[model samples]
Target chain A: MSKISRRRFMQISGSLVAAGAIPGAGLLTKSSFAAEPIKLGLLHSLTGTIAIAEAALVEAEKMAIDEINAAGGVLGRMIDPVVADGASDWPTFAEKTKQLLQRDKVAAIVGCYTSASRKAVLPVLKQSKGLLYYPTYYEGQEEDKHVIYTSQEATQSVISAIEWMAKQQGKTFFLVGSDYIYPRTCNKIAKPTVARLGGKVVGEEYAPLGHTEFSSIINKIKAAKPDWIYSTVVGGSNVAFYKQLKAAGLDGGKQKLLSTVVSENEIDGIGKENAVGYYACMGYFQSIKSPENEKFVKAIKAKYGQDRVVGDPMECAYNSVYLWKMAVEKAKSFDVDKVTAASSGIEFSAPEGKVTVHKTNHHVSKKVRIGRARADGQFDIVHESGVIEPNPFPKL
Target chain B: MTFRRGNQAPRRKAVIPAAISIEETFVTFGIFVMQLFNGLSLFTILLLMALGLAIVFGLMGVINMAHGEIMAMGAYTTYLTASFIEHHLPGLMGVYLFIAILLAFAVTFAFGYVLERGFIRWFYHRPLDTLLATWGLSLILQQTYRSVFGAQEVSVPLTTWLSGAWEPTETIQLPLNRIFIVALTILVTLGVWYILHKTRWGLRARAVTQNRAMSSAVGIDTNRVDALIFALGSGLAGIAGSVFTMVGSTNPGTGQLYIVDSFIVVVFGGVASLLGTAASSFLIAQMQTALEYLMSGSMAKVAILLLVITVLYFRPNGLFASKVRA
Candidate 1:
């Protein structure tokens, strides 16, 4: 009983014409609405002390997501990355993880560079039932249902490297590390392993974190005359330790230094002259020769730039993204429970080599490589192990 | 797995014998000498850092929380100088360090002078306010350094002359950098001593410290003295930063690491007393190095802090309290 106004009639006719122009408009609209992108969280410290190591991981993760999206994404849904900065603070990590899981409703998260930050966010992720893909060689003795460790544990990293060094270098070992949970735990594992390998631990010393003066420790090393120096020193201290070591005539060639933490990224800070001959053991090295690695290294360098060097952490982070996608595709759903269950035994042809998630612990079994640093800031792979099982709680 | 089982039984026995042999006198003597040198090197750096803090906190009665950041400014200056020299005049790289030190001092001096005139002058009488203000200033400076230099730690390349160690004995090898730092500390200390005791500006500064009203009445221009003294203190901190680059890496947060230790040295040395600062630095450094040699680093720090508290409890005024009229 009402007359349609001229503007109202125009609006109604315009919509009607647009709708009629497309066939099956109602069904088409519903299908397009259902094709929303899957949200995934990327939490990393973009600022603060740890950012030096973490920024590269973020870039690598982005690269993996891009690669997956290019290949039509997982289960026909594109990944929508929600990046958050942890700021190198532990509590901030927990807060960001909660926001990512509850607010953003991300299906999965791939982040946390330090053990402290990981431990801080573990409870939150468990409460939310969100999955986290942690990518770093950690001092092990930790396992959680909500997390998957993509890197080597203490057994695969510290124990394996020590045993190899003792066999190759000599029976006398000197242990030095920065005073913190990771280094302390690493030394705790190394101490017993050194004894079991029929080696003598000549000296064990720890400097406060950020402690630069290593003359005393270097002096003790000289006096002890240890055949091999097993170092777990991290951060800025590494530059001072290595430079002072070289200055004090304790070059790797003379003392045979081996570290569990130093990689290609660290060599940039320590300088080629200081780090060149030293040995580092990790799951991945840039110089690793494999079809998978070649493709990965090329893709990362091509995308990020040629000057960007891929380190152990970066490789593991990139692999974690792909592993998550594989698990999601296998599970056939974005539900956290399904993805977590399917995650077990999910194998990815990681840049390092073939890496498979252990059925029970959610830790990946990976090949550990011992690489001698070259003058060009790249590692020369000296020894590569077969697929070593992830032993989070080593009997030692 | 095979080695794990076979090694379990003998591990305990092997550790016990090794632990006993570590107590051998020859090894102990070598360790003692090494720790002493280590302690001396630590003391040298602490003294350089604390000397400036002593002047500012002791004489000015203004709690300068940004003392460490001023030192960081010096370090960054040195870094820039080295980078410039490395790129432009590679042939003069060996002699660049001396020039870098001077530039560090000048840059920090100008910075401190401007800071005092613009911000610090108003909060001189309010210790708590000055503390908060300077703390804020410290953070601002730290962030500024982070933005300008990027957060990653950078190290100055050691000149050819300072690259190696001088080994006097098979058991002892002294790093040339440490020796240089020690020598630099002594020279700076002597220079500071001469300025505070022998110079006209030093007399005016001391007078102002004792009686501000009387000094102003006598035409001393107490304001000028305060600004210059603050600038000098900051310049000394810059020198400390310059020397630190030879031993450690420089970053935005590097200054924060040493600020607490510098304050400890200053307070334990009786605040304004230069001699007290030197003595306390030596004592604390020795205690830390010796304790660290015996126990864990954290435990050593805790033990030394406890010892300092106990010592301070008995002598509330510090190690060498100067007699001054209220």
Candidate 2:
């Protein structure tokens, strides 16, 4: 039998009290005063395995809101940001969406990184007629009236990247990804695109999410000797896969490699040296030399830290907030129906570039860029394409 | 479904070899040998991961479900060590691993000692209670790690010496980090075997494990033995975590990836035998590697899990169960 000392009990309770403060902050800011702030939910996974990536997006979202607030928030009212953690679970995403809609009654939500999470939250948004600003690049297979996808779908990102790789890197390609809807659907688009060109998809494989071991996969890759290895391995598993590839003498120098999921943030975790020679396709990179991106980068670094990284997803997440604000101001109301109705054809000169909301579909038209990883945790832009229109349903 | 959407012809069919030639056979044989080397590396990692759980569950009869968090603590220790060395002692960057490895063990050992005194001690003789308590403790520890380290995976810079592989043949390469892990596992396993069998403390610990009341009646400090043994197990896991950063990412939840596999190895080896643990980890690592080489990673995992279930159904006592008068 043992007893927790009073000091220990207080230490535990103190942290619990601190955690209790977040929801209270969201709840207390009801429609009390005449100048009631417009509430927007910033939801993402803040814990669990996916937190390594998604937590950074919350920071980006917050930064966008802060900047908007600093510049005199939309409609002469400050944007009161309500944050929720999805905890890297799909059902939790749905539950959090419902709470943010019903309980908090937030005007709009800019959240979710994985397509699965978007799928989970879709029905809730539909049932409640709530608006969601989803900011992650994903497979293009669906569109909803209640959701505004602020990132590139599969055809915009996948087809262009594969075409570029096929032209420059090699004709024989190998595809690898985490086993999920995004990767599978992306590959489904990729196989046809590779064939459309005079290229061959030499092999394809997927490891489960969070898989750490990849020796045998590397062995198979080495034997196949494909001209280029297209990878979509996600989360912590990417670290193990890249390290093993380097060790097995399959360094990007030996065989060209391009990953859609590996970004500056991932390279930061993977040790830049391991990923330095590889290439990746993304919607944005911190290295993009433009006045808009430069200012956004400066502000982000100032707010976070000197060592903070801006990846594709983070940039898109940052874009999500600004796009939503533009819609709200254009509509001149905080109602979801009014804002969403006035959202189409809204143009924002974002940090990435100029992006325009589609008139028909609720997706953004954004540029696709290919970059080679550098040792300093930044990418060297190798190729940049014109802003491709979002086409969720690409015919093979 | 062959993807011939817009191509001139399927050049793939023309390139397919009619039969396996002699040169291709040699190449296949070479690749097979390289795969076996990979299997050996995987075996070492799994052994290091499982050895600690075996001791706590096997020798102490305490289900330390918080074992993985202890491993995360060690990994974090290593990360902090590297960061400190990089900032304060830039000149000693290459050799910082030696010191980081030691500090990982020390910090986790101390953590384990305090944990046993404060929490696990109360649940002694109640295995199910320890499971529930430790499972809760694991969540708390995970949250603690997240709060302390921040929710992103921190990078541990691998010095140039440990970055690449050792190639003995043109077609075969073994990663240096894996080689280092193999050497570390052997030394740690020997150290553990000696501590449990060659020393006087080992005798008392074994006595306490076999007959706690008798050992207590004969004046063995059963509590002290329990605390030390638990600390030893944690220290072993700490070392495993430190070595893991060379090959994997380190974050608050990094341990969850290996916890289930660690328990599987221990139970499959028979809960009470360290020798059985070594055998089982090797068997599993090789089987998975071999199977993965032939199939997709998810399919290989499914096959291995199903096989383990079948084996366990036949041998519930495990392959090397020992008779102890409890």
TM-score winner among the candidates? 2
Model 2 over residues A1-396: C-alpha lDDT tens digits? 779999999999998998899777666764443357888998899987678889999889999999999998888889999999999899999999999999999999999888878889999999998899988888878989998999889899899999998888469988999888878988999999999999998789999888899988888887888999989898888988888888777886776899888889889888887887899999999999999999999999999998898999999999999999999999988888889989999999988889999998999998999999887979999999998999998887
By DockQ, the best candidate is: 2
Every model's TM-score: 0.90, 0.92
In model 1, which regions exceed 4 Å deviation?
A: A1-35, A298-306, B1-32, B324-326
Candidate 2 local lDDT, B42-75, one digit each (tens): 9999999999999999988888888988888888
Docking class of 2: medium
Candidate 1 C-alpha lDDT tens digits along B1-326: 69788879787888877776744656667667767888998899889989888888888877999998999999999989999999999988989999999999999998888888889999977989999999999988987887787666666777878877787765556778888989999999999999999999899999999898999999999888999989999999999998887777677777877799988888888866888999999999888877776676767889989988987999876898887532
- Backbone steric clashes in candidate 2, count: 0
Specify the highest-lDDT model's number. Answer: 2
The alpha-carbon deviation from the true structure for residue A118 of candidate 1, after best TM-score superposition, in angstroms, is 1.1
- Candidate 2 TM-score versus the reference: 0.92
Q: Output the worst ten-in-a-row residue range by lDDT, candidate 2 chain A.
A: A26-35
TM-score of candidate 2's A chain against the true A chain: 0.90
lDDT of 1: 0.87
